[model samples]
Target: MRQAYSYVRLSSKKQIQGYGQERQWEAIQMSALAHGWDLSDKTFSDLGVSGWKGANIETGALSQFLKCVEDGYVEKGSVLIVENVDRLSRAGVNRAVTLLMQLLDSGISIFTFTDNKLYEPNSPNPLMDLMGWALSAQRAFEESERKSQMILNAKAKAREEARTSGKIITRRCPSWMQVNANKTVFELLPERVDTVRKIFALYINGYGTPRIGRLLTEEGRKPLVGRAWYPRSLSRILQYRAVLGEYQPTLNGKAEGEPIKDYYPAIITEDQFNEAQAILHEGGAGQGRRGEDMRNYYAGLLRCSCGEGMHIVSSKVKGKRYYQMRCLQYRISCFGGSWNFNKFASFTLFALRRLPLLELMGSRDNGNIKQLNDKVIQLSSRLEDSRKQLENTINAIAELGLNELLQNKYKQLTSLIAETDSQLHAAKSALELSHGQVAIQKEDTQMLTGRLLELLANTKDVDSRIKLNQVLRRYLSKIELEADKTNELRYIRIYRKDGDLLVTAECSHRLNNALFYGSDGTTEAMELVRE
Candidate 1:
């Protein structure tokens, strides 16, 4: 008996009211049964995929079908079953005909259920090929053009309405704002209003886009929709006038097209938004290049008190190499100046040495640990299930021979299995790291202190120093330096990695003599303070 593979497809989302996948499959089933062809279980269905995209495109089910054919999965003399010729493709008259001819040339016979016709490899039928295939292509092209005209007409109506009644159509709402009951006007999402305010505050406080993204992520603050904050996404928020209740048609998230007032509720005041824009306009100093061998160890770590990043600038004088950390916006919007590389490095080391090493390796509660463990187990189970499904699908496809129609499911299963495996591996790694943390309680502090002091002294090599710095960064978020009122003393303010100020100290220029300001209603917590 000849092997038969069923191919079914829906052109676009507009076809929902038209013939459905079930109807197409039903027709193929009846036709295959009547022809005595052995139908396979796997049926290729490209739902919501545009036929105009064609087989050369990377996406859609048809692309995967062609890939299977190229990989020598579909054998010659196999019967290809479809509800209709248009179900195979609506790429164009010439392209569709050429593709069908190629399949026929390969010894495959195409049986169209709708027409109850058989297209053979050698037989030429101009009437069926030209009239049937060509008409489908022409109809597809006309439908596509009609849809484009409809969109243009809708956009024109929306534009006219916005001009007259101040109401514009939007596809999606902004994170900080929501639509009203009628979906005609925008309103503030109360919970997200504070988030939008905080973003502006961060920008005004001197944190650049990249730094703000990191700060939000570390603080466990998610965006209005997505998992993590993006710098460009933040930049758009910074520049968006919608926070001031203005309607702006954005092109690529930038203000370009048109503007209307009072389209959205004001989440942030106009003055505040204007000030934030001014601060953002004064762009951070771009990191050019330092030296060939010398690298800035604190490139991403160092921040200026003026809310700008300190980049490394290298200079060679009298054959001696020198590096200095200068604020990107120094002498302009930033009053905080530059520092010598040695002085910056030494100050950072001094601050790091004074850190509580035991507390830095803080342990999570039993509940948190259990949650991580459970996550790993859950992901591993899912990974295993996906792998089994993939294996079963592959075996079924191989048993009936390589059917191009079935390969779309194979590709999807393979991708799903891979994604699950990756997620599982990441979960396991996080579980192991959580378990590995050496939490030193108050009783064990003395022992840990001695070991830490010993390690600090012995860490002389560049590699050892780098590792020690990395560990310090986990506990110490930033080190902001500024001169005191008298300009006789420099202050080194230490912050936690979560952007919280932990300790502030007045120190000598070299950070040799240090006195920390305490918050326990006293001026001294010289020992160690931890959460």
Candidate 2:
């Protein structure tokens, strides 16, 4: 029995009229019954997810389905059932075509319930493939354009209304103010207003953001979103001009419409607000030291232990400034601590020097050559099969009357043959390119090693470190830091350009501490372990 996986998607929560998930589900069940496809227990449904957003496929149920396909959980002969082409994707033609090709190339048949049509790997209809994909993609583009215009019109009208009526229309008033349902009237929440005033007073009295945050936490004063207060949150409140009764209309956190002055009762005087801003610029709580520049050499190559990207942040200790790498998600919820930039960079150089550079480069070149050769062989075989199928189809057409079904089949076979021929040509070209790369690497093997070693050895200065980082990034894909359950750095995994793990070394912090604190405190006395 052929297994079928149904994928359903509703772009919006307001889709209750014709494009509801229930209607799509019923259609998929009926189509499965008629086609003798055994519907699997697993159904991928992306409710309230707009397929037009390119992010939809990278997240949610669609991502899960793609993972299953990649992991071989869905067999080659499996069927992917969807209500329509748009249910699979409404992204642009490039994304849609790429996804369709991925599914078809895996030998999976796509069954669209709306048209009761089946799209197979070996048989492709230009009309069905091109028209279906193009129509859905076009609809997505039109819908996005319409929504954008609507938002612009709405904002413009709101700004005009605010200008004439002395009222500010907003999604949410400040934490100290409350708006009526229509947002035409604003009233002060006495307790929250008092808290906002106190925050402004604290900043004016020389309290920095971190101190203010600590004071708020101690007082049990809740913030707009969460219970605890972060320094950045307090900094934003101090910087906001809304405390002076000014309303700034923003779309996506960017100032869009006009600003309305005296929109609400003032919590602090404009003079006091200006003074606080001056203090902030003069290296107040939120501001790092002035005239101090820090560069993050491993900006794009470092990953946190929790699989999050690490970002550079500056900190001050005893009048000295330092730059470190912290997880980007640390502000929200992640607990992974920061890594000293210089320490991490030195450790990276040490690890790379210990590696057999020439052997690794040779292996990388040989691996690429082998993979390209395999791809060329596979495409050549498929091309030969497609040619044979097209020849047989043409012979059949000559013998029989040109029936509509036979004619459609002939067209499909011809399309498949053309597609296969194109793929074969691409594979041959790629094979040649890989061979050329291998030849170039072979000729410059010594020179490349010498350049890399020179960069690694002279990375004592910031400028040299930057050059070394760039060279390392060209050879290495990423360095992922994994943490233990206790939140300690466990190990750092290094990957080459091909996504293969090159080494798993002890966490740099551990090595650093051991080397600096070992007996005799000498470099020759240090021991290294690889795991």
Candidate 3:
């Protein structure tokens, strides 16, 4: 018997997760071996890549082997085994034909393990059978596309209905707005609304983005959407011209290219929104680097030395100098090179600083790192205890019958689980709590660490500036760098309080001098300071 290679593939998601691929591979290999074929030197390969995808497979050893056959690599009498016809290709029309014929004309005998059919070049009905397989592949492709389009259309229709009816549509809402039982307009917090109202008032009073964000966060105000009170959200509320109630449909989350439709109850007027913008950009103090941007650097390229922010600070050749664009999140600036924007423009140059960032862009801690072994032991003991208690409770219930027993045995079981969890937490804490010890939960820690290292190693298309961000997230928080020259980013600080995992940007003047803005002219701006 001629030597042959076995090919295994999954054509559809249904089949991909099923036993079909494994079964097919087993059947073909077994049959070939049974027929007195010497298979010890041969390779059994699987093209795990989805067949419908048109990209050439370089990494797929099995798939590449098939291609090699088509390229006159193997003898015509050599066997090419596939589990099923669909496993060959779901790519439609000409592309599908080109691939199928490549395998066929290579003179390799085609064998389908499932149907037990063999196709030889000398077969009279070869053309008819190939056509049948090709037609089936085309149907699967058409069906997949049709399903995708239907889902998208449904989503669009649902959004439209939600906008018109004034009822919130998505289960996913921002942090502040509480979903009501009836699913009505979001329940805006009365206290937070006052903060929102005051933000507008501050903008009217000539305050810019920095002061506004600081004031709100200092007052413990949060955005209507997300949990944290982000500066970007403040900008959104300020830019919304309809806050004064002029009623433009664009004020809502309408897409730009999309035809604007009348939607939402407009609270502010367009004039109010525009006035806020004017306040943000006008006057000697209000001169933005080039329209009040939220970003402090060129697409997050710079960090404040003070760990606040380093915006293009401008100051007039004046007596009392003030800084702008410094973060107010921190008590003080770390970068410390605060200047007013008006005078700084001459030095900073015409800053187009256009955003390439158009609104772009998880761990369960079981055992304690310091105390993993202790935690595991403690948890095991606790679990054992819970089991005993549960057994006693169950037996008592049987003896006492329904009326005399505990009201909810299930609830008691839940408490037992909680108790076990607490014991585990304590044990883990104790083990890892020692100063000079490796992590107790080493397995989970290693997994997370490995993933982070993978992210750092990928240098393709991304450079050092991007690397800084990856580094900041991995080792530090509130990463601040200062610019001494045209593009020298120095004076780095990571805001990592000891044993605290939360990493937030510290918004001191020294820190924010070279940082960018996060407001959209709808909010107030703060003066940058040099500390």
lDDT of 3 by residue, 77-193 (tens): 777776755566555666666666766677767777666777676679978767766776687578657776896777667666655654455545433235567766546446655
TM-score of each: 0.50, 0.50, 0.36
Candidate-wise lDDT, in order = 0.64, 0.68, 0.49
Clashing pairs in 1: 206-307
Which parts of model 1 are misplaced by more than 4 Å? 12-19, 55-58, 208-222, 228-232, 246-261, 269-271, 284-531
Candidate 3: C-alpha lDDT: 0.49
Rank by TM-score, highest first: 1, 2, 3
Q: Judging by lDDT, tell me the better candidate of 1 and 2.
A: 2
Q: Write the per-residue lDDT of candidate 2 for residues 1-531, one digit (tens) a residue.
A: 899998888776588445587888888898889988899999998887877775568897988988899899999989999877777776767788788888888888888877777888877575677667667767766776788789788988977777777756675778877887776678888888888788777665445566567677788887865667887887888778789888887777777534688877788876566656644543452222211112655646788867788877788999998877778898577776666665666556555555566534425544666877888788778878877877887788899868897789888877886787678667655565555444434433443456434744555564444344434554667888655647444455667766766666555444453222111222322234442
Q: The CA-based lDDT of model 2 is what?
A: 0.68
Candidate 1 residue lDDT tens string, 1-531: 877888777766766557687788888889888988888876677777666657433476656656666676767767778776666766667777877766776778888887788877666875666567668667766666788679777776785677678774774656776677797767766767888888777555434566567667788777866667887888888777778777766444564334677666778875566555433433431112322222554544677777677887789999998877778887788766567666555544544445555334343343466887788788778877877887887888879876776688789878887787778667655554444332212212443355434654534554344334334444455778675536666676767655666556776654345576632333532322221
Worst 10 residues of 2 by lDDT: 285-294
Displacement of residue 44 (Cα, Å) in model 2 is 1.5
Judged by lDDT relative to the true structure, which candidate is superior, 1 or 3?
A: 1
